[model samples]
Target: MMAGRGTSRRQLLKLTGAAAVASAMPFSAGSAVAGERRHGLSVFGDLKYSADFTHFDYANPDAPKGGKFIFRAPSWGFNQNIQTFNSFNSFILKGDAPPRMELCFDTLMVRALDEPDAMYGLLAESVEIEDDGSTYIFNLRPEARFHDGSKVTAQDVAFSLILLKAEGHPQVRLPLKELLDTEVLDEYRVAVRFTGNHTRQLPLLVAGLPIFSKRYYTAYDFKQSTLTPPLSSGGYKVGKHAVGRYVEYHKVSDYWAKDLPVLVGQSNFEVIRIEFFRESQIAFEAFKKGNITYHEEFSSKTWATEYNFPAVEDGRVILKEFPDDRPSGAQGWFFNTRLEKFSDPRVRRAIGYAFDFEWANKSLFYGLYKRSQSFFQNSVLMAEGQPPADELALLEPFRGRVPDEVFGEAYLQPVSDESGFDRTLLRQASQLLREAGYTRDGSILVGPDGQPLEFEFLSNSKGFERITLPYIKNLERLGIKANFRLVDPAQYQSRLNDFDFDVTSRRFAINPTLANNDRDLWVSHAGEVKGGNNLAGIKDPVVDALVDKALNAITREDMNVAARALDRVLRSGHYWVPQWYKPVHSVALWDMFGYSNEPPHYDFPVESLWWFDQDKAQKIGKGG
Candidate 1:
C-alpha cells in the first residue's frame, strides 16, 4: 500500500481556519502614501491576480496615465538568437513573451469579452472560419498600416508564413501545417485551405502572428532592422535600444490600433523600458534600489525571506498571488532519447523513481507547489483518474504501448502515500535502481559501466538553483552522480539548439483549445534538422499516428481521442521527471498600480485592460 501524503485530503480538512487565518495575517503593505487619493482608491480594496493572466481591467485602474514604466527582462537585455529574433515576426510562435514584455511587436487577436474562450480581431476586421473548419478567410481592417504608412496586405500575411517556416519557428507550419495552401484571394482577403478537417484553434494561431510590413523588410535589411527602430502596428514603437543594457518602447501618440476594441484597456503606459541584468541577485538588488517596478518570484525561499528588504518595510513593494488555470507545463530533467543511455525505456522509468518530489518540496519549497501528474494541469483532457470515456476513446488505438495503470490511475503515481516525503519511496527507488543494473553506496548509483551513473543537469535560471539543488542532493543519496551545470543565457541557447545536454529542465504550453500542440511537441515531422520541435527526439510510430489523428480531428470527440493517444505515448516513455504546479499566477509589483476585482478573462487580461494609477503611484515613489 502507498504511504505518501495526500495533499488533496489534507487541504479539505485544513480549509476550516483559512478565512480566520487570512484575517489574522499582518498587512504586508507597510504604509500608505499621504496625499489626495484620486477616487479615494483603497490599496487593498480589490485586486486581481494571476500566474499568466496579462489582461488589465479598466474600471478600477481608471484611464491609464501616460507615464514611463521600467522593468527588468531576460530577453531584452541579453543577446537574442535567430529564433528569438524571428519569433517576434513569427505568426504561430507569438506567445513567446518574456518576463519583461518584448518590445518589438504585438498580437492582433486579443481575447474577446463575450467569448472568453475565443479571440476577437485586433488588426483584422473579422476572421471567418467555415462551418467545416477546413477553410478560413481573413478580412483586414482598411487603413491599417505599419508605422511607415504602408498598408498591411494579404501578401504580407502570406509572406509572414513563408518566411517563418523557412526560418524554423517551432510553430512554423502550425494551423497551416495541415493546410494544403495559404492563398491571397484579394487585397484584403486571405484564404487558407486545409488538407483535412480544420481545427477551430487555427484562428487563434493566425491572430497571434505579428503583422509585419512586407515592403519595409524588402527595402531594409532583415538583420539591420532591429538595429534601427523597426516599424510596428502595435500600441508602442521602439524609441531606443542600447542592446544588452536597456530597450525602450514609446507609446505612439496616434497609434493605429488605439481605437480597436482589443486596445481599449491595455498598454496604457506612455513609455515602457526594460533593463537587462546578467544575474538575478543583481536584478533583485536593482529592484530594491527602485530601478525596476516589478519582479516575479520563482523560488520559495526568495518569496519568504528576500521580500523583507527595506522596500517592503517602506510600503513600496507588494507580494500578490492570483488564481491560475493555465497548464503548469513540465520543469524537470528532459531526457533526450536520441542519446543512447535514455533510449532504453527501463532506464527512464528508473530515473522517474529516483527523484523525490515530496521530500524536495517540503525541504526546499516551503510546501508551496503540488507535484504535477501530467502535461496538462488540472484540465480534464490532460489525463485524470480512470481515463474517462472521452480520454479512453483517444487512448484505445495505442492500447498496449501505454501503461494500463495510466488509464486507471494517475499518469504519475508515487511509491508511497504518506502526505509528504517517506523513506519507503527512497527504498523502492533504490530497488528500481538495482533493477536498472545499479547499486547505491551512500549517494551514488554505479552502473554496469563500472563507473557511477552520472549525468549533467543543465539549467538557465538562478531561482531554479534553490528549487532544484535539493533534488540533486536527493539524487546524490540514490548513488546517482548528478552534477548541476548552470550556464549563461547565450550558452544555454546554443546548447538547446545543438541538443547537447545530458538533461535539461524547461516547460511547454499551448493556447486554450489544445490544438496544434501535438505538432509542436511530439510529431516526428516537427523534428527536422533545420529547425524542428521534437526536443525530446521522439520518433515512435505510435506517437506519430496519434499526432496525425489529433491534427485531423474535427469534432471535440475526435480531438480528445487523439490527444489521449498522444498523452499515453508521452507518459509511457517517462521522458520527464515530474515537478510542481499552481493554478494561480504569482506576480509581484510596486503598489502603484490598481486593477479590477473581476478577471478580464479567465484571469488577468494582458492585451485588453489594466493601467497605472498615476496620482497614488507617484506619491508612493515620492520620497524614495
Candidate 2:
C-alpha cells in the first residue's frame, strides 16, 4: 500500500519535517565575513561541532568495515528509481538512474543527519560568505581528487554548478534558478554568486551539489543516458553492474577524503550492492533466501504473518524497528490538476471522501498505520485545530483567494465509521459533485463539459491493486468511472514525468530544515516543468508565495509559523487524497550488521551508518 521512498543524500538537505528550536542564534555576519574560515554551515545559528572536531558524534570511528552488503533499495530521490535504471548520468532528466548513484560523486559539503540542517565541508575545506549574502567563496581541500587521480579544481566546481542549472534534472535545477554565476578564483577555490533575491538557504543548496570533473564531461555528453559510469570523487566508485538487475559500488581504498571528519565511519561496506526486483513478492522471496542481506518491511501484513522462516527460528535473522523522529512528509494519491476534469477543488474534495482510511487500516493494513491528515504529517509544521493568531496574521493577505475554512479551523479529512462503506460520507460526496456542476447520467458522473468523470490511477507495482481496486469500487457507487492502470517501471516513470496520469501516489521525506529545492512541490512554474515534483500540478499563487515565505524564514520558530500557514492552504485545496503513515521503520536484517543502536532524529542512512560485524557474522554462520 506504500509507495517509493527517497534515500538520496540530497533528500536530507531538502527534507522538512519537525523543526527543533535552535540553542544558538541564526546565521550572523560575525563569522560569515569574507575571510573568516568556518568548517561548517548551518542554515540557522552555530555549528554543533567545533571546527577542530574529529568525527560526527553519531558515527563510530572504530566500526569495522570489510564485508559485501547487498540489499533492496527501500527508497531513492531525484531521477533515481528503485526498480530499474537506464542511465549512469543521474543528474539529467532524460533517463532512470540507479538509487545511490550519488554515492559515486562528492559534493562541496556534506550535511549531517543528526542535526536539523548543518553541512560540513567535504570537497571544500571552509566557505566564506559576503555581507550581501549573495556571494559565497568556497575554499576547496587541495587533497580532494577524482577517482582517476586528477585534482578537483575551481574550474570543475564552477562547471558543475553551471552545467546542472542548464541541463540537470528539475529537482537539482530548482534551487539553482537563483544562480548569477560561478567563478573560478583559483585551482582549489571557487566563488558562487546568486541573485540578490535568493533564499537564505540557497547558498547551502549550491554547496551540496555534486561536483564533476570538467575534463571528463568535456569528453562525454552530460545529457545522454549511458551505462558507462561518469568520473566522480566520492568515497565509493561504481563497480560491477548489470543494466537493470543490480549495481555494486566498491569502496575506494585510496579515497582522498576517507579520513575526513565528515566521513570517518560512514560508507562502511567494502562493497555495497543494490538488487532490483520489479515485484515486491519476488524481492521478499530473495531476502528470505539470503540473496538480499537487509530488508525494510513496508507491509504490515508481511511483518505480522511472514516471519516464521528457518532463518528466523535459528536466530540468523533479526527483526528491528528504528524510530522515525522526523516528519513523514506528504504521501497520497495526487490528482493531475492540469486536466480540466480535475481542475475543480470541489470535485477533488468529493473524490477524497470515497477513501475509507479506517477500513483500509483494519482490513488491509492490520491497524498498524494512522490516517495522514496533513502534508507535514507528524511534524510541528503541520496545521492543526484552529489557525493560531500568528499563522492567521501571516495568511491574512490571501483571504479572498483561499477557502474560508483555512481561516477558521485547519481542514481535517472526513472520518469514516470503519464499516468499509459510510453512506453519510458518500452522500456528502454526491452533494459536492453536484455543486461542482457534475450530473449523474444513469450510472456515470458527467462533468460540466458533458464528459464522464473518469480517471485512471497509474501504477507500476501490482501490490497495491487490492487497496486501489477497493477505492475504485467506492468511486463506482458515486457514478465516477475510475480505474487502476498498472504499467512497467520505465513507463510509469515516463508517464509521471510527462504528467500523463490522472492519479498517482508518492511519499516525500521532510526534515526539520526543509530542502530549498522542495519549492518545486508547490511553486507555480514547476508544475509545467517536464519532470518536476509538483505532481498534483499545483500552480496557485498563494502556494508559490507561501513556499518562499517558509523557506526564507531565518529561525525555526518563524519557519514553523510560515510552514503551518502553507499547510493550511494546501490541505484546503484537496490536491491529494491523504494516505496513511507509521512513525517506525520496520526492518528485517541478517544478524551481521552493527550500528549505534539509536538512529539519528532527522535521517536514517543505514548503508552509511551501519557496519559489518565479523563476530556477529561468524555467530550466524554467514562468515566470509
Candidate 3:
C-alpha cells in the first residue's frame, strides 16, 4: 500500500480550492428572502471572477515574490504528515501534523485557483446567505490580524467554528457534521449555523475552515497534540522546524490577507520548504541531491527509470509536464470494508481478480499509468457506457437498492491477459471465491468462519513492496493468506485512523466540484468517522443517498447526474483495486522557479503557484 497524503479533503483541502460556486444561490431562506452580499462562490458554474476582481486570472500579480521554495510534499492536508511529524497541532488528530499546515491559519474564504467552484473573501469581507441554505454571514476583515497582531475576531470566528466542531480532525470533524452553530455576530460579524441537513457544499466547506486563536486556543488543548506553534493568520508562519527533517513556511511580511482578491498571486514563497522523505527512493535521492526543490513525480518506475540525474545532464533538472486539469481522484486498492473478511460483494469481486493491471502496466508502471476507471476519474463525473437519461433519473430510486451490475455495465476493471497471473482471470477469481464462502481448506483459503484466509497489507510505504509482492503472488494462487504490513508513518496514520487494516493503498485527490469533501469520500456517515476519507469502510444507504444526491445538486447538469449515479454505485462496489492515473503532473523542477501561467485549471499548487527565479535562481546555482 503506497501512500502520501495523496490525500484530499487534507485531501488538508489539498491545493485549497475546487473551482466554482453560485449556480444562482445567494442569500435566501423560506420562500427565499435575504439576498445581496457576496464576493464570490460557485457550485460549478457562473463565477469566473467578478465583484471587483483584482487578482486571479491564474494569479501572476506581477510575479517575482522572494526566494527558497523547496519541495517533496507532492500532497497533504489536515492531519498532514507526509512521512514524519510530531504535532504543531495540525487541527488535531493528535500528533503527526506537518505538511503545509494549511500554511498557518486564516480562512473565512480563499480559493479560486482559476475558478471552477470559486470562493473569494480572505478573512471574510463579505458573505450573506440564510436559512434555506442554512444561514451563514461572515463579514470580518476589520484589518483581520492574528499571527499575534491579535484581533481576527467575530470572537475569533466564533472560536474557530466552536472549536472545530468540538475538537476537530476527522479531517476536521467529518464535513463538520452539517455544522449547526457558530454565531458571534459582533466583533466584525460571524453567524454560520447549518443543520438544515447541510451540504450544498456547506458554505464553501464553512468557507475553507482554519480561523482559530480564540486567544490562542484559550490557553492550549484543542484536543492536545502540541509542538506549540498554534496562533497564525495565513500567508505562512511557523518557520524553522525539523522533527521529521524539514518544515519552514515563513513568508507573511505582514500577511493579513496579503492583498486578498482570493489572495493575490497566492502564497508566493519567501521560503515555503517541506521536504520529509521516508521513502519514494528516499525522496528520489533528495531530488537527485539538489535536496528537493519541487519534485512531484509519484513514481512510474522512478519516472521511467531514474530521471537520468546529474541534474538531467547539466540543464540542472527540469522534466516538467503540468496539464493535470483536476479530478484524477481515487487511486486504489482500498478494501478494508470494516472487515468480516471483507464482507462479500463476492469477496470484493474476488479480490479484484488478483490485480494484474495489465501486468502492472507493463512490468511496473512505465507505460506510465492509465487504468483508474473513475471514482470520478478525469471527470464529466465519470460513469461511462450505459445509464444515460439523466443517469437513469438518479438510478431510479436505487433500483432494488443497488448492484444489478449497478444497472448494467459502468463497472469495468478486470481486463488482464498480460498474464502476470491471468489463468482465465484466476479462474474467474476462484469461482468468485467459491461463490463467496471460500474453500480450498486443504491448503489455506478457508473462511465461512472456519478461519484461514489471512490479511495484512497496511503499509506506510515500502513503495508497495514491489507492488504488494506481485499481488501477494496472486493471493497465493488463490489459497489466500496475503502479508506485507510495513508500518511507520506514525503507524500509517494510526492504522488509517483506527479502522485498522486488511488492505490499503490510497490516492484520493477527487476534486472537480462536489465538495464538502464528497463527505470524506462516498459517505455512509463518513465510513464511521474517525479521521475520514472513507478508506473503504463505506456503509451504504444507497451509497448514502447517492452521496446526498451529489452533495445537493442544483445544476452543473444536476451535479453531473448525481455524480453519474454516484459513480455507478461506487463502481458497483468492488470497493477498489482500481489504481493508476496520470492526466499529467509528473514534474521534476530545480531549474529554479517562475510559473504564473499554465496550471490552475483547478489547481496544480506547485508550492502555491511557483515563483522565486532570480534569473532562474542564478542559472540553477539555486540562488537567493
The best candidate by TM-score is: 2
Q: Is candidate 2 or candidate 3 better by lDDT?
A: 2
Task: For candidate 1, write residues 345-406 as lDDT tens digits.
Answer: 66777667656676666666666778776765565446555666766665665567666765
What is the C-alpha lDDT profile of model 2 across 466-549, one tens digit per residue?
A: 899889999999999999999998898899899999999877776677666778888889899988888999988888777777
Query: What does candidate 3's lDDT look like per residue over 1-624, in tens digits?
Result: 224436654213620011123322433232223555877666543677778878877778877788888777777766777878888887778788877788888788877766666777888887877655577787888998887787888988887877887888776677777687888878898888886756567678778888887777788768998776887888788889888888888998987678776667767778887878788788888778888877777778887788987879788887878787777788788888888888788888887889888888889886777888877888888988888787887687668878787777798888888879989988898898989887896668897888888887887788778988898889889889788888788878878888788888888777677877666777677788777878888888776767666766666678778788888888887887887787887778888788844787877777776777788778877775
**Following a full C-alpha superposition, what root-mean-square deviation does model 2 have from the true structure?**
3.4
TM-score of 2: 0.96
Candidate 2's C-alpha runs over 4 A off are 7-31
The best candidate in terms of lDDT:
2
502: Cα error in model 3, Å: 28
Candidate 1 regions with alpha-carbon error over 4 angstroms: 1-62, 73-108, 113-117, 129-132, 173-175, 221-226, 413-423, 437-452, 528-532, 550-565, 601-608, 622-624
Better of 1 and 3 by TM-score: 1
TM-score order, best first, reads 2, 1, 3
In model 1, the worst 10-residue window by lDDT is 6-15
Q: Give the clash total for candidate 2.
A: 6
> Each prediction's TM-score against the native?
0.80, 0.96, 0.35
